[model samples]
Target: MLPAEFDYAAPASLDEALALLAGGTNIRILAGGQSLLPTLKLRLDRPDLVVDLRKVPELSYIREEDGEIAIGALTTYADLVASDLIDSGVARCLAEAAASVGDLQVRNLGTIGGSLSHADPAADIPAAALALDASLVARSEEGDRTISAGDFFHGLWATALKPSELLREIRFRMPANGGGAYEKLRQAASGFALVGAAAVAEMDGGTIEAMRVALTGVSSGPFRLHALEDRLVGETLSEELVREACDKAGEAIESPLSDAHASAEYRVAMAGVTARRAILRAAGQWR
Candidate 1:
């Protein structure tokens, strides 16, 4: 496949990227190029300008500051997986999701920011982000703004990011050490999640005090299962109760996506199955 001819500029700084973005329409921002490059090669898009942010060093960091883990948008999945800053339950869930994307090479090349900005409903990172209640920081010529993970995804292959905005960083509150895990059924060919689930919990003896369950690949976007969390929280779990909550994982979606690899009914059913295993893994109830 051949791409349409387009003007390209690799910006050295965030300010330069912002100026390029604000200056015109049809100017696409390029992060890792894992998604956009494929779109371009397939002739799915024809943009007049491509602003590359690969050289912007400031946008590649993983650190703990304030009350959250500050992750620059350019922080690669490999970086997140290898970072010591990924210590807590929420961060561990994110690391597991990052590790699950593609293979080793893809993890090395794919940026967390790029992955989230692409907003593919099947991608694993979004479920982790949503489960951990992460916030995305965007920079534009106008100013900076923070978007909650719940508000960030507009729909399939869509996000709240405007054309003029560059995703700067992602931050999530540091969860105290407890338990976290991500589980998914992957599409063999693309390695995209057929249905992905992430769970983060704060445990008190045999009880869960705080918990979050999020899912991807089953709907138009990733989402938290608040009702399921409500049912699990503050309860001393029995296998029966955990099994019941996992059955409701599909309830996170208003509508499930049916694609060539999976039917919506199959995905919805897998949603409950996978989430059950994921929650069990997080709670140390199952191996």
Candidate 2:
């Protein structure tokens, strides 16, 4: 399908992109264009202008400084998968999720910032973001502000980013201890998650000290299973216990999606299954 005519600008600098965004009321920012381009072609979105950020070199890097790891918004899924920094320890789940997204071509073209900004309910990245307790940095003419991953995702195809804000970077606190893992059931056709779970856990004296479990593809948005986490913490983790705790995975979801690929009930049930697997894997009790 041919897209509606729109003025386009490829900005080499973020400031120029910000200027374009501020100057236009109906404008779209194009990162990898894996998601936005499809919407444009379908005429689901008819922006007056599109500001391409591909030439913005500063927004495509991965760096670790002090106690934080900062990843540019333009960092692609392929970059994440190939990164030694993301392949193990705390950020492993994020890499796992990135590797699971679509195929080789999609991974090469899909940006972490673009994926999170699009906020697709079935996306693989958001669950990892939630588990990692990531922070998103948004830049605008006003300056930079940070948004926690918990507050960043609003609902289906929605995020906290304002029209004038460009997602600059995603930041994660360096993993002091423990490990994390991502687990998902893919939708056969699109490779989107039927139910995706991410879990990060720190153990003490062979018991669960701290843990985070997050799920996507079953709700209006990806969300942390705090209720379940709270229950499992301080308890010696076991297959039986994790299985029991994860039964509450769907209890916190206000709106579970029901689509042709999977029913709400099926998703809710799989939520428990995936969450349990992720939790056990992260805690090092499962392989």
Candidate 3:
């Protein structure tokens, strides 16, 4: 299927892009077009203008600043996977998730911001970002506002972003004394996750100090299992404990979706299995 006819503009500067968006009511910003083009082709979305951000130089860099890592909104998954600045456990998990999105071609063309903005419950980045405690910086005619990953995702295919706002960058505190991993079950054809888990753990003197667990593909949005986090912290990091924690985490999730590929019960079971595996991998329990 072909996308509907629409005006296209590749803006070289942020101001130009912002102005283009502000000038039109039915305008969609195109980052890599990996997600948008398909939606457009399917006629799920129709815009009067497609504002391309590929020519915006400043929105494509990855850098470390202060105590956090800052990734530009337009940075591709391939760029994240190849970046040297991303060295910590959180970074590794995020990079792995990026690599796992679709395929090599999609990774090279898909932007992190695009993935987040699309807000697909099955997308890996939102869960990974939640585990990393990432924050999004959005800009608009009014000003800039920072949104935590927890608050950024509102519901199925929905986000906190206003029509006039543009995502500028993502920021997250660097992980230390910890490691992370993301585990997912993918659809054989599309490679999108049917169920995914992202885990981060910090160890202090053989005891778990801090941990985060997030799940995707089973809910309206990526969600963190805080009840499970509380149970795991201050406990000895062991297979038994991890298994129990995973079970509790699965139980804590409110109503996961039952789709054609998997039932709600199956997704919940897979969520527990993946959570345990991810936690073990992040804790170096797997060799």
Candidate 4:
């Protein structure tokens, strides 16, 4: 089906885009058109105006500054996969997640900002964002504000972004020492994750100094396994300890999603399976 009739504007500057957003109600910002176009075609969202940011060349970039990697809102998944800077540690988790998104076409066009803003429960990036301890910058007519990844996603398809705000950039700090990995079970048809997990582990000698484990596609929103992380910190790194802690992976999920692709019970079980694999891989324990 064709998209509903709407006014369109391709703004070359972010300020211009912000001005357009501030002046209109029922406005949608278009980055890569990966998510929004399909929604528009389905009439799931009919807006008064669609502000396309494709012409805003400044918003598409990847750079590192002051110990953090800053990714522009319009940076494509393909860009992430190709960047040499994102090859290790927490950043690698984000890169791996990007590599796993849909197919080549989607990866080529889908923006990281667009994926996070859409906040789809089955999206691959949110889990990595959570594991990497990312901070998202939201731009509005008023100014810019940074929101932690933990506080960003409110629920299924819902986020902290105000209607007038656009996600401007995503930031991830370089870990002092650690490795990270993303693991997922994809649905056969859509390539959307059935259950995805991202894990980062910082080791001090043989002890686990700190660790983070997050899950997506199993709950209303991607979330960290804080309890599991808390249990592993300061403990001696061992296959047994990581495996045992991961067994409680689904314990914190109060409402696991149930759908035709997989049952709630199956998701709950796979949560542990994916979490274990991700944690082991991040810790360099996986063979």
Candidate 5:
């Protein structure tokens, strides 16, 4: 499990990190080393240089701003779980998803930014981010750009982040009055999502006002249940309606990944099941 010999740089500041990245694509950014180390051990990623960001103290905070929550790219899963910001509302789904990542060890070591940037279809964070309609902040020598969570994901193990850029932070508007849930069918060994779903909904007098449903592990990337969410608006919460909407949960998947752990069909089926569970729980607390 030894990685190939490569040059390593642990930059002390974001500017230094950006400078190194500007040098070339052969340089990989290391945040938490949670995903990068595994890829290196597998020899799946070959890089001439590895730039570590752990030493950069600036990119590791979670705070509130103007009715929104700003999450640093370096924030770990354990941080998400412990933050008071996640006790209720839309952020609750993110907290639950973070809590379900691997075990306590992985949660302690894994950064939310690394997990999202890795763009693993089976990973938990992206689904919750999508459900919350978060935006990603990416910085480079050229300038800074804010990308919507919907626009950040491209495909399996892919993201819109340019090689010369570093993801600086993630931001989402705080929900005023709402409820949400994250439900997953977990793989036995890895604890990664076999099929996971996150739902956030707001109610206006027992009728659905705004809602989002995003699914992971059944698609090439996390995505919202657009049609289902649209159908839910103005509709009163009902078991039949919830089931009917969630039945189309896997329809957005373009190309699904299948392995020994679970087949594509099983993932698709469980996506529907978990989505139903998530939306039902979200609906339950809307009152």
Candidate 6:
């Protein structure tokens, strides 16, 4: 289906983009357009103007500063996969997730910020960001605010971003002596996750010092299994302990969504399985 007619503007600067957004109530920012274009074509959204961020050169770089990684809003999934500065474990996990997003073409065109802003429950980045304890930087006419990944996602297809605001960058403290992994049950057709898990573990003398486990596709939004993390912290990393952590994670999810690909019960079960696998992989048990 064809989208409704709309005015398009590819702003060369952030201020111009902001001006376009501030000028109208119905304006959509086009980053990667992987998600937005489809929604527009389906007529799920009708915007008076489309503010293309692609030409905003400032929003497309990755840099490391003060022991944290900063990714600009326009950074593509493929860019994240190719960055050598990111930890090997985290990069592998992100690359795997990015590669699974639709296909190579989608990965090359899909922006990290676009995916997060879309807030698709089954998308891998939200869960991965949660596990990494990432923060989002959003800018608007009023000012800028940094929101934790946990608070950034409000619900299914929802986010903390105000209509007038644009997400600038995503920042997170790089882990030390820790590794991470993302595991997902993919839909054969779309390659989107049916149930996905991202796990990060910090080991001190072979004992867990800190741990984070997050899940997607099982709930309305990506969420960290804090209860399970608490149980794992200070415990030795082992198959048995990982199993227990995964079980706790499965039990912690209050509600799981049932979709065409999988039932709620199946998602819950897969969440546990994926969580266990991801944690083990992060812990270097499975390499």
Identify the candidate with maximal lDDT. 4
Candidate 3: residue pairs that collide: none
State every prediction's TM-score relative to the real structure: 0.95, 0.97, 0.96, 0.98, 0.95, 0.96
The C-alpha stretches of model 6 lying farther than 4 A from their native spots are 87-92
Task: Provide the global lDDT of candidate 5 against the true structure.
Answer: 0.88
lDDT of 1 by residue, 8-29 (tens): 9998988988999999989988
Which candidate, 2 or 6, would have the higher TM-score against the true structure?
A: 2
What would the per-residue lDDT of candidate 5 be over residues 1-287, giving only the tens digit for each residue?
89998999999999999999999888888987878998999999889999999999999999989998899999999999999887578888899899999998899989989999999988999999999899999999888899999999998899999999989999988767677789999999999888999988887778988899998887677888898899889999887888888786776666776889988888877777898889878776422
Predicted candidate 2 versus true structure: per-residue lDDT over 65-128, tens digit per residue: 8878899999999999999988877788899999999989999999999999999998999999
Local accuracy by lDDT, each model? 0.87, 0.91, 0.87, 0.92, 0.88, 0.86
Clashes of 5: 0
RMSD values, in order shown: 1.5, 1.1, 1.3, 0.9, 1.7, 1.3
The candidate with the higher lDDT, 2 or 6, is 2
- Weakest 10 consecutive residues of candidate 4 by summed lDDT: 245-254
The TM-score between candidate 4 and the true structure equals 0.98
Clash count in backbone of candidate 6? 0
Q: Identify the runs in model 5 with alpha carbons over 4 angstroms from their true place.
A: 285-287
For 142-178, candidate 3 gives per-residue lDDT tens digits of 7789999989999889999988888999998775777
List residue ranges in candidate 3 displaced over 4 A: none
Residue 124 in model 5: lDDT: 95
